[model samples]
Target: MKVVHVDYRINEKINVNQFYDLLVNSTLGERRPVDDVECLAGMLLNSNLTVSAWVEGKLVGLARSMTDFNYACYLSDLAVNRIYQNRGIGKQLQILTQAQLNKRCKLILISAPTANGYYDKIGFTNNPRCWVLERDSDISI
Candidate 1:
């Protein structure tokens, strides 16, 4: 399959009704509502940190990251359609995102709780320098 990696600006024009559907079909059992895809896509678009893959004009894979453009980046979602799995689409998405990030940024990602091994194979090692704290999303700003 011929694949291309382009920035999320393309998402705006994609036939994403199915794109959203495929993401919701993730076998990892994470089924997000379509509304969540719309909201997340909007936020990522505005942040200038989303990239996606296309095959024959169809949205086949996607990944998004938040970056300071200088020092830090957090990769949020990395996905490839079920039909396209094992075809190297996911790796291509990561390569594209990393190429955009380069050496100037510290990259971090939280893999699906069950799919931790895949991320490790791609050169991500555990880092002790970071700690995460959770706050309710509804908490006051």
Candidate 2:
């Protein structure tokens, strides 16, 4: 058997290029504002918790989240390079992300349509109560 190592980290500052490259190589690129450098910068700058996976100093996987460390944690983005998927990197990213939070802080995320089964198999239950509000959309109550 071949032994492989994946380094999992917390709060490490990763540059936009590294992050952009990873997203471009992953399935997430399609859904992100990759062409918007400012948006990418803001996303990283605003995230309070970031767990990353590195292989030989190269950014391979990342989990960017926003959390209060007390009540709730919203995992905004979890992406693994397309070539590196299904090797347990994504799961490790989530594991490390949740590890940073208090036990009472429920880790939550809106799964990509393609990733729904993946989250379910990794101990996340389905919750239809989640809602979204796009920037241009109006709130009518």
Candidate 3:
């Protein structure tokens, strides 16, 4: 089989279909709202930082994040095509994402249940204090 060249780029604009495809092709699709195109579009349009891996011009992996470049970075999405998972593309994507952050900024992500072990193996410390308020939920305070 011929080898496809892989390239990594930062802050590249990836369209919704490409984003949806990559998400769905990876395990993340099960947890993401892939059927909602508008949501996916909004996600790509609103993210402040995005690191993507491409092979022969097709998006194969991505790291989408929102950060102020100073204190904290929320790594909202990290996905690699199932076919591309073991080749280090996902790790490289995270590395590129960190390269754009300020020295004091720390990357944070809520691990998908299936990916917890992978994150642990990659030097991520498990933090048990994360909390979330669903979009449809009301504030009680």
Give model 1's clash tally.
Answer: 0
Q: Give the per-residue lDDT digits (tens) of candidate 3, residues 1-141.
A: 346678999999899999999999999999999999999999999999999999989999999999998999999999999888888888888888989998889999999887899998887899999999898998786
Task: Report the C-alpha lDDT of model 1 over 7-120, residue by residue, as the tens digit.
Answer: 333223434475575576554326344567676457445555656776666766776677885788787677777777777767777777777775878777776656677778
Tell me the whole-model lDDT of each prediction, alpha carbons only.
Answer: 0.65, 0.92, 0.92
As for candidate 3, its clashing pairs are none
**Candidates 1 and 3, the one with greater TM-score:** 3
10-114 per-residue lDDT for model 2 (tens digits):
999999999999999999999999999999999999999999999889999999999999999999999999878889899999989888999889999988898
Which candidate would rank higher by TM-score, 1 or 2?
Answer: 2
Instruction: List RMSD in Å for every model shown.
Output: 4.2, 1.7, 1.4
- The regions of model 3 sitting more than 4 angstroms off are 1-3
Clashes of 3: 0
Structural similarity to truth (TM-score) of each candidate: 0.72, 0.94, 0.95
**Cα misplacement distance, residue 49 of candidate 3 (Å):** 0.3
Task: Output the worst ten-in-a-row residue range by lDDT, candidate 1.
Answer: 6-15
Once model 1 is optimally superposed onto the true structure by TM-score, how far is the C-alpha of residue 129 displaced, in angstroms? 6.3
Cα lDDT for residue 30, candidate 3: 92
Question: Which 10-residue window in model 2 sums to the lowest lDDT?
Answer: 1-10
